[model samples]
Target: MPFDFSQSHFVLFGLPTTFALDRAVLDTAYRKLQAEFHPDRFAAADDAQKRLSLQIATRVNEAYQTLKSPLARARYLLQLNGVDTQEDTNTAMPVDFLMQQMEWRETIADAKTQRNVDELEELNRQLAEEITELTVELAELLDEQHAWSDAATAVRKLRFLEKLNDEIGNAIEAVLF
Candidate 1:
């Protein structure tokens, strides 16, 4: 009841406003808030109290989900400041980046066609390493450097890596089946 429904997630939880969050603190805040505002805790109260509890609970869930993922957190921060991160509108990736992606896709396709598990595993390993590097780059841009523009670029790279990850998984499944 003391917490304001009008507050943002960081404000509601009395947390600092930042792109990179401490997971432990976030989890603790989420658990504490959920326990405080859970509808079950308001079941014995009047109808209005129960309804308010439900709304607060829903807000908490939305905040938790948005703050938990790097991609979602970045997007939320941009939206919070009235910025449209129209990643798709740019549609102009460097040609070298596109070529690299195509090469990886081709390598994956060839590996699957030959039922070469070793090649698939090696590709997966390389992709995983690359993704890890991209993650670090994103963290540095978003957290340490506070370079939102560069962070946006990093997000694009991360998205591409995510797509490649899915494609690699599909290739693995095909080889297995």
Candidate 2:
């Protein structure tokens, strides 16, 4: 079949529509698609064919990226289920989660102020654990339970944890530097 831009990313990659995916399968499929539609392969083709190849290649890359990240994959599944996470518009997280987030921020700020590499590393470990736990919860919600609303909440929490993880890495760099 010809390439179809309108198809879902999972459909494009011949993957099942779920949050849990095999990384090896995704990598193989992405590489196969890249080899098939890479713009370099179209150098000798007509201008229209080259343009089409470029477009298909771009779409393939976008799909690969979206499917590769756990958070992105969860969000895409939620969107497909008609659940708009709406990060900006829907900011109503549980009160306990909000408090925990504040605590993490304060801990980050304190670690930065003290220039404590060990403490930063500890925080990074903690965040990594939380990310792992949430990822499991997300998979259960999205794949087994089909709990779209809970999955949306899980996606938002994962986003926050990811941002915090990045900040912790930056703090570690600053301390080491």
Candidate 3:
């Protein structure tokens, strides 16, 4: 089959290495491909064939997940381009972005001290909006403009936003609790 589950997501889906992808197309293709090579459909086949089918099915699920998430997709694109974001490397962001992050942290800290859930929620909303804007910026940098070097820097910022976003969610949960 042309769509080899063992192949990378880009190869399997015939997509370019980019964050922006047609979700509908990916989902539809996955469903159709699943239907075709489902192990159950090959129940009458030999043991090796059935095992191979199972392996291929697992690969398809893994690839789908990696492609679905923006962060994962970005990391994958980086790897494909011979860039390795070291697993242990601490993300170093620019001073302006660091200053913005510090402001966010201060706001969160101040809100917590004041015991203001509304303020916390508002901060979360703002961060969420910023994350959305960064996501679009990432797509433009990686796909439209072909700016990998710049995109690499943006990805580092994105990692920070992701961490902050998770912290905000946890903060909300703590408030609710």
Pick the lDDT winner: 2
In candidate 3 the C-alpha lDDT for residue 102 amounts to 95
- The 10-residue segment with the lowest total lDDT in model 2: 84-93
**Can you write out model 2's per-residue Cα lDDT over 66-146, one digit (the tens) per residue?**
999998898888888899987777878899988998998899889889998888899889889999999999999999999
If scored against the real structure, what TM-score would every candidate get? 0.82, 0.96, 0.85
User: On TM-score, who's better, 1 or 2?
Assistant: 2
Model 1 regions more than 4 Å off: none
Total colliding residue pairs, candidate 1: 0
- TM-score order of candidates, best first? 2, 3, 1
lDDT by residue (tens digit), candidate 1, 1-177: 765767777776667777767899999999998999999999999999899899999999999998887777777765665666667876556788889999999999999999988898898999989887876776777667877777777677677877898988889989998
List, residue by residue over 1-177, the lDDT tens digit for candidate 3: 334545678777667666889888888878876887788987998998888888777777888898988877877887787776553485677788999999998887777777778988998889889888988998998788878777777778878888888877777777777
Error of 1 at 114 (Å): 3.0
List CA RMSD, all candidates: 2.4, 1.2, 2.4
Best by TM-score: 2
lDDT of each: 0.82, 0.91, 0.80
- Clashing pairs for model 1 are none
